[model samples]
Target chain A: MRLPPILVYVLRRLAIGLVVLFGISAVAFSMAYLLPSDPVTSRYPDITNEQRAEMRRQMGLDQPLVVQYARYMESVFRGEFGRSFGTGNSVVQDLAQRIPATLELASFGIAFGVLVGIPLGLVAAVRRGKPTDHLVRVVNIAIQSVPAFWLGVVLIFLLYFQWRLVPSPIGRLSPMFISPPPVTGFLTIDALLAGKPDIAFAALRQLMLPALVLGLGVVSPLARITRSAMGESLGEDYVTFGRALGLRPRQVVLGDAFRGALVPIVTTLGFVVANVLAGAAIVETVFAWPGIGRYAVTAITTSDMAPVSTCILLIASSVAVTNLIVDLSYALIDPRIRHEYAR
Target chain B: MGEKLFEIQNLSIDTRRGGVTRRIVENMNLAVERGQIYGLVGESGSGKSISMMASVGLAAPGLLVRSGEVGFGGRRLPASDQKGLRGNLSHGVSLLFQNAKGALSPFLTTGRQVERVLAQRKVPKPARPKEITELFRLVGLNFADLGEKYPHQISGGQAQRVAMACAMASNPALLIADEPTTALDVTTERELLRFLTRICRERDMAIVLIAHNLSLVSEYCSGLSIMHAGQVVEEGALRSIFATPLHPYTKGLIAAVPDVDEPHELVPLEGSVWGGRNDIVRCRFSHRCPHVRARCEAGLPPAIARGGHQVHCVLYEGEAA
Candidate 1:
């Protein structure tokens, strides 16, 4: 038996989507390569001839350019994401250690953003001229324009310096005691499992500035988009159909309004993730967080192209995967847009 | 009080434009009796759709109701308050949008979508299973396997039936079909309406069938209201309106339809409906009303009722002139 037309379209799109992603990765990778500075030379000033030769052999850098490229692709396909030249550790291991933190931050930030922003946006749309709407708009504008780095710095200065409310950013954990073997690899989760409130609090304190900075930056744009989308959806013909059916305001908003709102929200997620990744690099360095972004910057400064490649792939894959998920969800959120293909 | 199942009394809609208010639909009134199909016929932007949407309190953002009292089931419609209206009207009233494909939720299965309507209205637990099966059967759909299918799996006609089934889920007192068959092919349109007529007859459902097609309503509607520029230019029994269209716009619309028996030349209405962001002292149709007189532009015309037919035109001011 054959699958449906929409399913076929979805599969075709997935195939096409993969090709498009590959092309995007190629362009981004090429640009990264073209940028000035290599990480190896910046880190190691005095390298003996033997050390240089050993490093070359270890990196497979002495091989022809085509040979190196082929090997990189081969390893990438098998999930052996090369080694970090700066720390001389497996890139996979580094990723395994850092991914959970970045993801936790990004996911939490999005959840927080959507939870807060959607309501604010709805308020802005419903009460367009009222003081509440104006205040939200003003706040959104402020949040949108302020740089995440600057915002993070200010939050730390005020919340950390004056109040001494949050725990110090001691790299995903506290300095007061020893920790377990980092099961789950998320400090908060690990802290909970170990029943150590100190570690959990430390983890939360470290997480606060990053999550706030990331979530804050996203809240404005997300809220604005959600508001406008809700407004637009509320005006759609079907919403009238809903009202004519005598649906409640809450019903109209959730069933009718929210359905229409997803198109923008899904599209916005792509931009949000891009912003988060970019911010991740800067934020990681700022907080001295031992994440991939921090490692990537260090690897780049030392011209460790292998680890840099891994980082590039990680970010690229993340963006591609997120975009794909959002695309798939479009058909789910709105029943009107029937997919030509889905698997 | 009991003559008509629904009555729109002096309905008017106002829209804000550039900080100025202008009337869109003014003092429009119509009656839809139980077991009667009332067709609302008009060209695009003639306020036909807006009138019905507004009458049911479905006016979207930016469009405000200047004045109106829509009464159904002995209670004045709470158009101004959406919260107050939901419980009373929602389960009792269902609207079929123009685009069948666009109207139904794309994500949900046809059965599930129909089930949601049943669920939201909180259909009694015992009656639900039996009712679901009966509804599917009535709409010419078999739930044996097809009910599991999504909107994409079905044809346009089937999707419409599914939508109809959804609208009929709670066994509504009124079924408001806004161009239900416009998206369907002729054969399918005919088939769907036949099914609709059958169901209405069996269920005693009052239908407010809105459409641009005058002939379509002529065939189905027992009564009809003709709208032009947000006003009911003419309204009466379908047969009466067809026999002698009181309004010039109605006359033009009837004239435009191709008749096999008459075999007459088609005369399309000359201009489009008026669209501007300005106030009007005179009649809106005056800009396009072929029977326009100098005095017709002086003030807003009243809906002159004679022998149960109302035509908002200066020519009808005299008794049966």
Candidate 2:
């Protein structure tokens, strides 16, 4: 009884996510192995066929595709991402070290997106027929259209080159600071917890440029969606009923109208997560923000098999996690969906 | 049924254009006594909903009252001051919309939706388990048998009954049931109407029953009005209006109702209720009137009264007669 409909829904989605992860792992493995370069020969030039064969036996590259896939899957199932062919370091360890910067940037980007976008949407909705809405419309369209890289370049040019207002772009911390203790593996929060407030601020400052570029794009569409949905919701009979119930303007907007408008708005955020994850590769390269994307880039350049496949599996899992979160949110946002999905 | 609830004096609604404002409902005067059901019957777009919604100061966003004075329970209501009438009055005066499915919040449980109106009154909250069970039972739901439920969990008739239960939550003095049975099936409609009429009698509450069916209005309402293009064309006691329809539109509407006493073919109305907003000076229904004449369009038609009944046709006037 404790495991009710929502729990069942979550379990079903997790199974589906696992299946998708397997598919991704297969594609990644095949692509990695199918590439022209061989790690044994490429890394060790003038290596004989006998030496390469021994290396192949140890790496299990001689095994059938299915057996190799099952073996890789078994290791990944046990939380072993295998060793990187390029660096000879465990892929899991590399990801653990790099993931903090990506999380900091991505989470901050989401925060700024919601903060800026929701207000613009409300403002546009309230001033619907006037020039204010029109201006907002134009701006929203413009913001979404502007590429993240271009925005990053423009902001970096204006902030760093012109005035030199921000900290150095070399790393997640300033020249003065040192690494904080790894707790949740997030540097900023870990810094704060370590009683290093200055280091936390420095980490935040480093993330600011990349966060702004990524966030501005996501925010524009959210604002547009909120405005349109609010306009529709405000006209519903129940909203009129809410008004008649003597609810104040603030109470009406927040309580009845906003919630009614939020269904579509929340759904849109799911797509945003997927887009941001994919777009992270570009943003990461631009800001030198180390994450899976930077790791994948290095793997691809040197044609590293095990690391690239493992990274692909991780990215696939993130996409699946994003979808699961979205599905869970639907039940919370509108119980009607939960009721239907329970069956 | 008790004492005076509201009085409408010279209520007029006009559709405003660039320079000229076209009159839709004109010189609509009526009164709703306390604990009484005042049925307002009309054809589609006859402005029954608009006139009543306006008379109670509840018009749609675009439609505005050009001139009117509404008195509720001895208190005068100015058109400009619409704020006071809501909630306190909304609690006192609940609106049962035409579409029950559309009225209740889809997200809320049927029981919570019912309890919501009660919550508005600043009353101490009732225990959820007891109140929801009782409310569901009152609305004729077998609360025990039904699996943990939401709005979509219930049937249509049950949903409407839930709507009624919600409306009754505030213990309202007046219920503006705007075609409350319009969306229900024949059997459900009859059952729901009977339930509503029963609630009105039991609670001693006033109801403004708006519908297109005159026979329905005649059955439930004590006193009633027939609307034509936003104007109150004819109004009096329900029995009197049925026995003797004074206005031409009222006569047409009565004639249009299929003879229930003896099964027969329906005599559809000769013409439609349209183009009234564009007319500068005329009885708007003149084009539709079988006995229409040049005199009907000469000016704004005068209302001729007899006892409690008022008819807005030129035939009763001295010169036209």
Q: In order, what DockQ does each candidate have?
A: 0.35, 0.34
Poorest stretch of ten by lDDT in candidate 1 chain B: B78-87
- Residue-pair clashes per prediction, in order, are 19, 0
> What's the TM-score of every candidate structure?
0.85, 0.87
Candidate 2 residue pairs that clash: none
How is the predicted docking of candidate 2 categorized under the CAPRI scheme?
acceptable
Per-residue lDDT of model 2, residues B1-321, tens digit only? 457876777887776667667776777787788788889888788777777677555576557677777777677876545565452455477777777776666667766665555565655675555665665666566666542567677777887887777777667788888898888898999888887887888888889898988877777888988888767778878877788887888887787777668876677787777664555667777778877888887854656765457677778776432
Q: What C-alpha lDDT do the candidate models reach, one value each?
A: 0.76, 0.76
Top candidate (TM-score): 2
Residue A128 in candidate 1, Cα distance off native in Å = 5.4
lDDT of 1 by residue, B1-321 (tens): 236788888887888868888788877888888878889988888888777777666676688877767787778764565344444556577788878766666556877777767777788777777787788999998977668887777888888888888888867888888889988899999999999998999999989998988878888888888887777888887777788777788888888999988899999888788775446667777788788999887655676776556677788787664
lDDT of 1 by residue, A156-270 (tens): 7788788888766656666676665577777777888998877777677778778777788678878889889988877775566545555456776777677778888779967
Return the top candidate by DockQ: 1
